[model samples]
Target: MKKLINDVEKVVLDSLTGVQAAHPELRVDLENRIVFRGGTPRQGKVGVISGGGSGHEPLHGGYVGTGMLDAAIAGEVFTSPTPDQILEATRGVDAGAGVLHIVKNYTGDVMNFEMAAELAAVETGVRVEAVIVDDDVAVQDSLYTAGRRGVGLTVLLEKIVGAAAEEGLDLDAVTALAKEVNARGRSMGMALTSCTVPAAGQPTFELGEDEMELGIGIHGEPGRKRVPLASAAAVAKDLVEPILADLDFTSGPAIVMVNGMGGTPQLELYILYSEVAKLLKDAGVTVARNLVGNYITSLEMAGASVTILRADEEMLRLWDAPVNTPGLRWGA
Candidate 1:
């Protein structure tokens, strides 16, 4: 229950205020809870927008900048943003080119974003397309998802697709690239501890001292199963095996991310990454580029997730393109 906040109800708003103050290069519409790049929307450039519940920092919000998301809408912690709010963001960021909504495959998120797209079309004649990410190989059905939950691959999708958009790719081309990225990626997560939502003031779930939950979702929902705690290498095998089984990453270069689920320290994340690298090499998957650390998190939950994206030459080149954002920045 110990949280660094003034009021439980104001957590999302208060944190967004801080984000606005910290990054002057971005524009924060506090009233609408939208974050956009601090410049004119490039003419003819496809607009990329993604949104979801709050608490997963540096996600939809931290990614708003050059060569990434043009705008991000925020909702209450673990809650979907309203359709009106998403519509505002779409209108604000839409240039002559259409806007692409990079929606995760959660039910509420999908529904809300769809509603927003429809509203934008009817009200302003803004063209909108959506690319739903459901790369989590955890469970077929969950509390919030129909097939698989969108997990770490959302981060990779935003990066690669953003680069394509920045390169002036049209909306149709960007949408196609986004779907290709989603199809080529797979993710699996584990949790050593549960997270405490600020409003709830209690842990969402519990884990025994010698236990771990595999195939965990980002919202602290129950994972596929609980298992006795084991060595880092064993845990790495469990995560990597499912992702490899779900996709044939051996066909080309791969982009690998060992993401920390908030409370896990960098020391342990590196240890996990080492094991993941070893396992991928043994499976004949060539790692062309890798990202390690807490890119996508589940509040203060202690654990990590593995995301693997099979990359062709075009995907790899786009990934190397310059990106400048609060969460991810390089070559810019």
Candidate 2:
């Protein structure tokens, strides 16, 4: 409720003004609220784009840049972008090689992106494909999604697939790789506190001081169950166990992420990662690459999520590719 803002309805618009000022490398469309990679329509390269509600910063928007997303559409807080907005992004980025839509498994996102794809094909004749990331091992259905709600693995998917597209892979190849990445990843999260939407001006949910919600969604949806607050090591077990049970990560190298839900400190994240790394090691899951930070987050929510991707050599190589984006960058 005590957020720094002029008006509730203008949060997205106002913050986008800052994004435009800060990251000139990204072209921000104030009218449509779409952030496109600067000098876009990179001909012959498969265009990669993703979108969802706001609040999850550095996600669909913060990722637009070299070796990542070509465009990212932003909606109101926790609200899906309309089909018209999505179609505009698709049209703006396509340069003959086609476009890939990386969508979370939320119901609104899925439907709207689907509509946009169809519209792009019919109206602009731009080839469009989509990959739905439903890697959350926490629940099969949530308040916003029919299947498992996509969580932290989305960041991994965008980076890997964007690298593939940057490498000049065709639309079909990029889409296939994206699907493969989604298939290999699994995620689980826990929340210590709930987030407040700017418009609502109050916390989305309440949690007792001595309690934590395990297997929480990014949008403050109810988790698997609430339990007594536990130690970092115990919390790591609560997250890693379901993911390991869902897939066999021991077969090969894995890419792991310990992501903050927004309000958790970097100090606490590292402590949690220490415990997570040990658990993966004990489980014989070799972590070849790792990210520990606030990559995807709910608005000022006190929590963290774990994402594990069972990776192959190609995935590792692409993951190491140069990326220049606000959210993630290295080797650029």
Predicted structure with the largest lDDT when compared to the true one: 2
- Residue 306 of model 2 has an lDDT of 98
Cα error, residue 104 of model 2, in Å, equals 0.2
What is the C-alpha local distance difference test score of each model?
Answer: 0.95, 0.96
Score every model by TM-score. Answer: 0.99, 0.99
Off by over 4 Å in 2: none
Distance (Å) between predicted and true CA of 311, model 2? 0.7
lDDT of 1: 0.95
lDDT of 2 by residue, 1-332 (tens): 78889999999999999999999888999999999999999979999999999999989899999999999999999999999999999999999999999999999999999999999999999999999999999999988999999999999999999999999999999999999999999999999999999989899999999999999999999999999999999999999999999996658999999999999999999999999999999999999999999999999999999999999999999999999999999999
TM-score of 1: 0.99
